[model samples]
Target: MDWDKLRIFHAVADAGSLTHAGDTLHLSQSAVSRQIRALEESLNTTLFHRHARGLILTEQGELLFDATSAMSRRLDTAEARIRDSEEEVFGELRVTTTTGFGSLWLAPRLPALYKKYPDLKIDLMLEERVLDLPMREADVAIRMKEPSQADLIRRKLMSVHMRLYATPGYIAENGMPESLEQLSQHRLICQNVQATQVSAGAELVRELLTYDVRSTLTVNNYFGVLQATRSGLGIGVLPDYVVEDFPDIQRVLPEVESKEVPVFLAYPEELRQSRRISAFRDFVTEEIIAHRKKMRQESESGA
Candidate 1:
């Protein structure tokens, strides 16, 4: 069987349609269909069943897909190894991170990295969603949550401490809660994502806010919650690093403590040995470690 034809068939099977696969592979839909047809003919078995939605994989196709997926990954890893052996840091480094951190921190520091390695090109994808690194969605990922995947390489970069904060105006108008028990009297801004997750920060909020806590406003993004808190809408529990720079917001109930959320850096196991990846990994690790103390100080000083 032609390797190219097998590759095309695999792409189509994974994408669920000829047009989608063609778009991904930068080939014409007809060419992709022809390749799949040729592969099926050579193998003397029907690979896909035609359906209204798209092509559904047959039994043979499913088995082929499983093997082909592994084979493709190995081939890609080998290619990466070969390129790295040439000592060139001149390839695309796809990075995935959350919006708040990417905007406030990582994006600003990228220029220094580029200055050091002019040949390296970076594709920064910032979103709240964690992109799958093992599936080649991103080369490296910086996430707020620890990765539970056993296949990938994961490292804890730092612990992010969160605190309850409110605008001075809101606190003055609503009467500041003297203790954790009085928290329910004031309006509260809740983050939907954080509320749904049982993190240390979430647990602390639940424990402290015993009074009829009003969750009038809900937002998915931390930045939105920060803005709401800054606008004097309500008090919100936010990362200290995120809210420290907002002059209008004041930390409330500093005694009401919560757990620290550990930030993690993750990447695929295959790319661990690549020179460029290793270089970047080392550089980022050093930078974060060196700045960890400063981050903590900034949080404490509300800088």
Candidate 2:
């Protein structure tokens, strides 16, 4: 089959109109229609049925569409790899990371990275949603939780030790919770990732003390919860590394400590050999390791 014809067919099927497909592909309307006709002839089956509303895919077209979609993605991945290898480290690197880490840590360090590799373009997407690496959704991912996907390469960046933190005003007004029993009297803020039965941080807090987890204000993002806590909203649990520099926030109860959450840097196994990925992975790993001592020192000082 002609790849160009198939590409046109895919565009037409997606747009549901020859004119729209032509505009998208920068081809004339007549050219698009001719390619579709050729594709149908080669396939020996009708692909689309036209109506006043739009073109509807026939049963044969739907089958072919699924296969072609996968093929197009694979081809795109191959092309990206080839282009990355051929050129200098000058292409775009798409990365997805959690909002808290991206905002607090990664965003600040990107300028230095850009300075080091002036030719490289970085697209940093701050989202909680896990992107699919195999589908080429993102070139790299930095997440708080470990990924279980077998096809990708996963590297543990660091373990984030969480501690209970509250603003000075909150502690002064509510008084510091000296022990587990006293913790129940203060308001607690929760950070929830999904609709899971229990959050790891919350579970750890519960396991450590007899505090009332029942009375809590839950937020979706970690940075929001941390900010809320910093503003004297309530006591919140956050990664030690994130709040280390905030002078207003103080660790409330040293007796109650949450378990450390592992952070992972993930990428497709095939892209491991690529210089861009390797360079990024190594830079991030070194940066995190360098900050490990500072993170520990902050936790200790706060305690």
Candidate 3:
């Protein structure tokens, strides 16, 4: 019934030790124990099973702990939103994206963002797993496809295609493949078809495999594939965006490409007004524009 008692119980359940919880809460063990006892008496239930090593939550304690955890997350969301209302775009902004894009593309452009907002703290989570933005798993996400989750504000950033590439030395040494049939002569570097990659990329790799490539090197992520290609290991199936940063890697079999994989930036509807989110979204949009311009200029010069 008492908010203070609920808070104490939450901490104790989280730590599984009365003394440890007391240290975290800045209260003595006896004081914390008194609060837990008073709370249990008020609820008419035993919240934890006593043991010599540590305390274990009873069934009732588990239910209460679950409720408290939800409350804690909500409070965190509220705190972040409140901080966002301030004038400065400063504080931790958790961003999630695929390892390939995060490392190869986004990470390279982060300096400009830091220059503009030096006070901002970024926590970059690079993985294939899609975080739950609405549930606050991450504050923002840049995904290979449009998010299917409900209550998200999604924006399409750009589209990418998987294309073959190789180092000039590798091409000179092994010769280039001019057609699908000729591709079989060289080793293929790519993400394994079974790995967690965009459907379009996986499909391209599958089609490439059918060419009966003489040898293959499959990595779980595009970063690994890029590294191998850079090292002159073999022709690699990689996203066209990679060419922006790695101009030295020549595109092989230009006509051989995959279906378009749309990239999207998404955030929770509740964070629509967050200044931190706005700053990050605008920064990425600007970078995309600049990237497109640079590529176009190179194309015109070559033409």
Candidate 4:
């Protein structure tokens, strides 16, 4: 039950070699061995099966090692939390979102955040996979739909629609499709109906596919679709938000669009007071405001 013995046992079990554990702990091999022995004797169990190469944990040892490992990790996290500056917004913040949004929208706006919090470290995890914010898989998430996970503080950010777009060159060459029926004449670029994407987007792609488009380029993510569309590949089914960044691409088939897909920002309820989370939340809020303003101005100018 001694803490020191448990610590030595964890190091030894992790390394599986007494000399290696000793070297890591800055203790002699005999001393490390004594600690392990005393711990095993106290628990009345054979903690290890020793061989010439090293040691393997017995079932009992495995159980004890699991406990010690958890303890060690918790302690390390505690130490890190303690080391954080309570008054400053600084530390690693793991942010997760779909690749399309991260790369097209959020990633481009990060320089302002970096300017404000030069010390802050941001790990941007861009994927379709929804990371668990409550379990700390990621510190924050900006998702296409509201996260239904428990114990999360969620905020509605905006709504986006899946609309058809094509580069000027492509439209000029192929002639723009004026109606849904006419869309079938041009190659459609979009996310595969079965690919991991927002349901609304997939549904839009499915509906478009039903029009019997003769040729298609289906990418897994909107980023890929956008790149193909930019290259004058075909008419791309993409989120309306992308138009804010890519102004040259004109919308096609004005009546053909998906229902609005709501976007949400979520974080763990337990992180309500985390300074890093607050800073990031505020920064994103500001960016969203600016983005909306820019879009409004563009809309007005075009009108």
The residue ranges of model 1 lying beyond 4 angstroms of the native Cα positions read 1-88, 172-175, 193-198, 243-248, 296-303
Positional deviation of 105 in candidate 2, in angstroms? 2.6
Q: Rank the candidates by TM-score, best first.
A: 3, 4, 2, 1
RMSD of each: 14.1, 12.0, 11.3, 10.0
What value does the lDDT take at residue 264 in candidate 4?
95
TM, every model: 0.60, 0.64, 0.73, 0.72
Rank by lDDT, descending?
3, 4, 2, 1
Poorest 10 consecutive residues by lDDT, candidate 2: 190-199
Off by over 4 Å in 2: 1-88, 192-199, 205-210, 213-215, 297-303
lDDT of 1 at 289: 76
Clashing pairs in 1: none
How high is the CA lDDT of each candidate model? 0.79, 0.80, 0.94, 0.91
Q: Can you write out model 3's per-residue Cα lDDT over 142-255, one digit (the tens) per residue?
A: 999999999999999998999999999999999988899888899999998999999999999899889889999999999999999999999999999999899889999988
Give the 10-residue window scoring lowest on summed lDDT in candidate 1. Answer: 190-199
lDDT of 4 at 88: 64
lDDT of 2 by residue, 1-303 (tens): 998998999999889999999999999999998899888999899999989988999999999888889988999998886776655566689999988788878887787778877887888998878889887899999987888777899999988766788998998898987886676787777565343322567676555445554467677766787888988878887767765457678777765666667899999988978778977887798788778877767658756
C-alpha lDDT of candidate 1 relative to the true structure: 0.79
Global Cα lDDT for candidate 3: 0.94
TM-score of 2: 0.64
The CA root-mean-square deviation of candidate 3, after full C-alpha superposition on the true structure, stands at: 11.3
